[model samples]
Target: MPDTSQKAGGRRNAQSRREDQPMYPATLKVAVIHWVMLCAVASTVAQTVDLSGEWRFKKGDDASWRQPDLVDTDWQPISTGSPWEQQGHPDYDGFAWYRRRFTVPTALRDAEAFALTQSLLLSLGRVDDVDETWFNGQRVGGHGTFPPNYAGDWQAHRSYVVPNALVRWGEANVLAVRVYDGSGMGGLLGRRPLLRAATWREVVRLEWEPGLGDGLFTAPRPIAFQATLHNDSPRALSGDLHWSVEDDEGKELSRSTVAVALPAGRATPAVHSFQPSSPGFYKFVATLEPVDGTKLLFSKFTGYLPESIEAPLTREPDFDAFWKETLATLAAVDPQFAVERKIDRDSATHEVYEIAMRSLGGVRVRGWYEKPKTGNRSPVLLRVPGYGQNMRPTGSDAPIAFFSFNVRGHGNSQQDVSGLPADYWIRGLDDKRGYYYQGAYADCVRAVDFLAGRSELDPQRIGVTGGSQGGGLSLATAALDPRISLCAPNIPFLCDWVKYFKASHWPEMDKWIEARPERTWETTLKTMSYFDTLNMADRIRCPVLFSLGVQDPVCPPSTVFSVYNRLGGRKEFRAYPNDAHRVNGAHRAVLNAWIGREFSRPAK
Candidate 1:
């Protein structure tokens, strides 16, 4: 497949955000972020009232139920997140009424103590079908339509602005929701309902220079951004604005503070200019603490010269020898291969089987295999699974055969070991030989051997692919076994172990390390180096196609590049800038095409 690139990114004010990159005509070729953030603000003004949990519910709707004075003591208590069908209504749909009573604390209604505006947004998440919402006997807003020429969308989320007068501020208030579902699930069906104050997103339109890209740039050129406030309120607002640009490591490179006033009913623009000294990812943050309005926060992540990113190499001197000896030692055991053809799963177009084989420690492992029924010998794709996931038989209609292999400690291979514990990453941290991945990697190689043993499978055309942990296994399998001809890894984990811990964090990962006195990060990472894909990247010579989520906190793109940049083979990658750990369907389409195109070539 030809290398592909296009526009993609996600954004929200001050929340874990993605930035839009602007196209720059300057010869410097840097992507202008058009975003900046405020830092070290004295205060931010906002309030959130959680309205989730149990609420009074009834099977049928009554117009009087919307009244605040109605006594609903006999109504059933039902949770707001799930549909009424799941809360015991069964297939019964049509109309239902939900009522909840809450007290708005005086703290949230104060409009004069430093913060002037206390606008309320009642977020009911996404409700199936249509709903008419009421607060304290007053119809605030609603969504879709009901009956007579019925038209409503299940995908439409419910957010309604509440007028200050109806809130019964600092007093008890009653909320009611009248919903109608023509079929299937009904009632509030997504996130819990809540009321939150409007943030910077409501008052500002942040514009970056050259509006073509989002969160990607070139190095050595100054980054430019400006924040504009809409100031649509009744009076002019004055507040302190704090802004800064920081590197990926959270180190502040530039920062400044200033007091600014925004004129009412107009747009006010505040622009800033700065340049990053080197290539990599940088973040811009801005905060607006309006003296009498809601506090707004902003952050945008941008990348510069990402291709030049380099990670610290921690490969042990005996890394190659360590793996060579282990493989040699494990090969001494008989594989004890077994295959059971599942007649029940077979079709005219494909043959299905449950297969097993022995790997390190003579431990037996299992996987699901499905081969095309054609007599022609075809290339095989060894499919792998992500961390702690169970994989079913891949019935992909693609030209090649698919073997969904599971390493020990996963799926049906739990006979020898099980990934039952959540803290698998930290298990066996003391010994390199005992680490969970040591045996898992060997299990992948053993699967390759099993694939090669099949007379109908083209060993020279075998390709390995998966996401997350499976992605790491794909690279490791190719690195350890010369039989693998093509490798495709997406958002791969288990690379650049030291950096992985720094870029992302998990409560389980931290608790495990903190629980033991002898476990130092230095010693743990030293052992991890043996299985590090970055250390093994140079050994693989097959064509490699990598896809990454640039915003992935689990398997940082920088760490993925450390392995990609070091590969001693033909390699190309497609990046999704806004993704966290998983690449979406966009990458999957490219991967399928890339696999089909690469496998068509003669064996190297």
Candidate 2:
């Protein structure tokens, strides 16, 4: 059984209360009390000035533009928080200038004159590449050196402090920024710029790291709860750090309260350790708040989960029958294979062929077929693509026949179906027979059928491989077709739909579910059971190789293990500790070696 307790502190929002999890609100109750306490010490004195309006933009470099009195009446008007590509400069590179004028608040000027405020911090969000900012006529701050030795901090969030002398009290201030983008999209591509008190923002950072060695946490492992209290305000923060650990189901397992004082303009680190009694998912949440103040310094969440977890199958009653009938329907159609030789994609070692074949519902699917020029019979490797991706020619130099298959609703096959994911994934969900993946899975089986019919390919040594949606199709193809002898799936999707619907990290699924309240969970699960890879796991008889990431939010690691645990074939599994949907390069090397070794062996 897949333990929800294991994912307690996993991906997404930790404080989320699921239908299956317990409803005891230890954190919620504490939050209410904290809110009341924060209401007692109210003091709002800091001021914030918004500088996000239209700015005068001029392309190319000019040192004279940075001057406070420079005129830019002919410059184009552009808004912040949008990339230059979206602002009619799609291919623009090199230096560009953005100039904006804003009036300083009278109150802020008065406070500065009386020396009541610390300093003014200009928050410029994130600038793609490098930038130099000038307030009035003086240089306030800059990130990265310009020109020949340009070292661009492309993803840096810029925060520059303006010197007290630079402020022309209550007057209009000219803020000129010179930005250089090295490649692709650039310019102000993040949050809008703003001017605020240096001591207004306070932050609390939380990180949960394992106290022991990496990889799967088998049982009774120690986890460290690290919290850093940051006091950006000029004042100190004296508060109690209320931290707790809850099972995946939101039941409080442990709690702690530490009274500490945070100094002004500094970060203080606090460390706590807890050993889980057994193996499961748990969440560690920390909230730092002053005893009698309205400022809730921090209430952040992080998880402490096992490396591996398993989920139950959401199997339909006719799971086998549905696929059996679907494949039978595909077999009924004559796969009129249209093979066109592509000279451009061909090499001296391999001959490339663009193949189009008829699949279920008469949809024409496409694939790039590459076979060794000198070989009459070679092992066939069928590669599928990730979600919505078109199948392209393989870059592999392996001595094998490679067929990159693009199922219906993808690549050239989209002539009859939409390529948009939201349109396809939920299409025909009203009936299991008309579900989109039924045709997609049939298309995969048809790809295998095409390989089996080719005389130059070894039908007995055909294998399937892909990542994400491709990974799910790989498993489904091997399960539906007996011609496939080996299969490797990486971070596969469309598995454990029941579990996925409960806590889906993907926005599309949530939006789909939220858009239709009448469908309910029961109806959705029934329709998904037909496409769930977990239900098809038991059907795959070939040697299986699976890889999944521990921190994968799109396809939960627990649901992936459900498919792995249910497989009744020779199989191997690998888990990447700090990966999301994609695995690392080292694992890719191992996967290639494994597939090569599998193809080299005799057909079972």
Clash numbers, per candidate:
14, 11
Model 1 C-alpha lDDT per residue in residues 457-537, reported as the tens digit of each score: 888999898778888999999999999999998889888887677665555656667888987778878888998998888
Q: Report, for every candidate in turn, its global Cα lDDT versus the true structure.
A: 0.72, 0.70
lDDT, residue 563, model 2: 78
TM-scores of all candidate predictions against the true structure: 0.67, 0.61
Question: How much is 154 displaced in model 1, in angstroms?
Answer: 14
User: Which residues of candidate 1, in runs, are more than 4 Å off?
Assistant: 1-214, 225-240, 258-272, 291-293, 343-349, 506-517
Model 2: residues >4 Å from true position, as ranges?
A: 1-208, 211-215, 220-242, 246-255, 259-280, 287-310, 374-376, 505-518
Candidate 2 lDDT (Cα, 0 to 1):
0.70
Give the number of colliding residue pairs in candidate 1. 14
**Once model 2 is optimally superposed onto the true structure by TM-score, how far is the C-alpha of residue 376 displaced, in angstroms?**
6.2
